[model samples]
Target: MIEKEGFAALVLRLRAEGVTDLDLLTAFEQTPRTQFVPPQFASDAYSSRTIPIDCGSFMEGADLAAKILSKLQVRPGHRVLEIGTGSGFTAAVIGRIAERVLSLERYRTLVTAAQIRMDALGLRNIIIRQMDGSSGLHGEGTFDRILVTAAFSAMPRFYADQLVSGGSMVAPLILEDERCMMVRLTKTGSRFEREDLFPVPYLPLASHIAQHL
Candidate 1:
């Protein structure tokens, strides 16, 4: 568990970083980041840097996580999909607000670790699967909200197609300059509208191009 002072410090830092949603901030403060991190790095859990997790992946910064979750605009009865379930921390946070959270992780090690963490926290609303996040899960559609924690060169069309009308997606899109930009995409009729939110850096999702020779 994180101390109150440490949690307060995290909240202040996130607020300064432009995470203004009180509900998101409260969720971040309530979740114990330390528990999701490796035991040796527990002390640094509240720090503002990304800490390495299993399978060469790392947990996103607390501020970035808060910002992404804030933009998700989840509600009590919303169905959510989360790509790249790192330590299951983000999924757990979404589970708290959304009616159901379906998260995917490609790495078996990370998937196992995340499941363990979620079970320990007794977060039953999240269903984790070991599958490719870039391609997205099949047979699930009409999600009220979708989130991709990993960076991508372009928005995955599959994800946009799965969103329910009026649903929104928050992801880090890698531009030509190799810089990452946080973008929010909201479904409007048969099309989706995009809004650039902020600049961010995150590990890129393992794409098909990388998987094949």
Candidate 2:
């Protein structure tokens, strides 16, 4: 858990970095990063660096996570679909803003732990499942917003089909130049608009689900 002073300082730093959204900042303050990381990395919870978690996956730094969520612009009435539940920290934060969050993880261990954290925080609107997100969540109906924590080598067209009209999806994609950059795709009826945000070092999205942790 972050002390009051620590959270205040973190919020101030985020504001300085341009994450001034009031609701987003409140979500960040309410969701403790320490609860989503391993015990050994608890002290590094508030740091601007990724930390290893169970199932060999890594949680993105708090600052980067905040920036991505801010760009996604999740509203209180939007239903969010999160690909990669990681430490459940991101989903918990989204839960504070979105109407509902469905987070998918490939590892069962990660899914179980994420669910426990969400329940402990009294975030019942967030649902976590162990499933391969390579193709996105088809047949699961449409979503108002989608956030993918992993990098995709190419545009995930399948996910685009699952988005509602005018919905937006934020994710990291590998450009032709071999640089992984954060990109956002907004659906406008039958077309999707692309917007490159920033560069990020994110793990590639696994094609297959893990059979074991």
Candidate 3:
């Protein structure tokens, strides 16, 4: 658990950095990064840097997480589909704002670890599953919001296909030239509208759930 004064300072810094979404900030306060990060990186959990996790995965910083989740425009009754449950931190944050969240991760270890943390945090609205997230979760049905954590060489049509009409999605779309940018997509009557957000650096979406990166 983060100390009260220390957590207050972190929240103040987030505000100064222009993380203006009140609900996201509240989620940040509710789920301390320390509780979701590896023990070695606990001290630097609040830093604006990505930290490494097991199986060669990395976890996003609080500000970036806040930005993407805020972009999703989640509502209290919205069901979310998260493509990566790297640290379970993002899913946890979304769980606080959305009605329910189905988070899919490639690595079994990560899935197990995330589930443990979610249980510890008492976040009952989020479900962590070990599955190849690139394919999306058809068995679980569609969702009102979808978030893709990894960058892809092309827009992943599969995920877009899984979104309910009028639903929103935010992901980092990597181009054939290897450049990457965040994109906000909305499903609309058999078609999906795309909006390119700002540029960001993220690893390519894995083709399959590998034992190691």
Best by lDDT: 2
lDDT of 2: 0.89
Per-residue lDDT tens digits of candidate 2, residues 122-208?
A: 999999988998788887799999999889998877776899999999999999998999999999877789999999998888977
* Alpha-carbon lDDT of model 1: 0.80
Candidate lDDT (C-alpha), each: 0.80, 0.89, 0.83
Give each model a TM-score: 0.91, 0.96, 0.91
Candidate 1 residue spans exceeding 4 A from truth: 208-213
TM-score top scorer: 2
Q: Which regions of candidate 2 deviate over 4 angstroms?
A: none
Give the per-residue lDDT of model 3 (tens digit) for 30-76.
88788788988887787667899988889987567777777888888
Q: How many residue pairs clash in each candidate at the backbone level?
A: 0, 0, 0
Q: In model 1, state the lDDT of residue 117.
A: 85
Higher-TM-score candidate of 2 and 3: 2
TM-score of 2: 0.96
Query: What tens-digit string does per-residue lDDT give for candidate 1 at 1-213?
Result: 455766788778877877677666666766788888888887777777788887678887666677778778788899999888888999988887788999988777777888888888888989998777787777886798888887888766666678888898888899899999988999898777999988987777785322321
Question: How large is the C-alpha RMSD of every model relative to the true structure?
Answer: 2.7, 1.2, 2.0
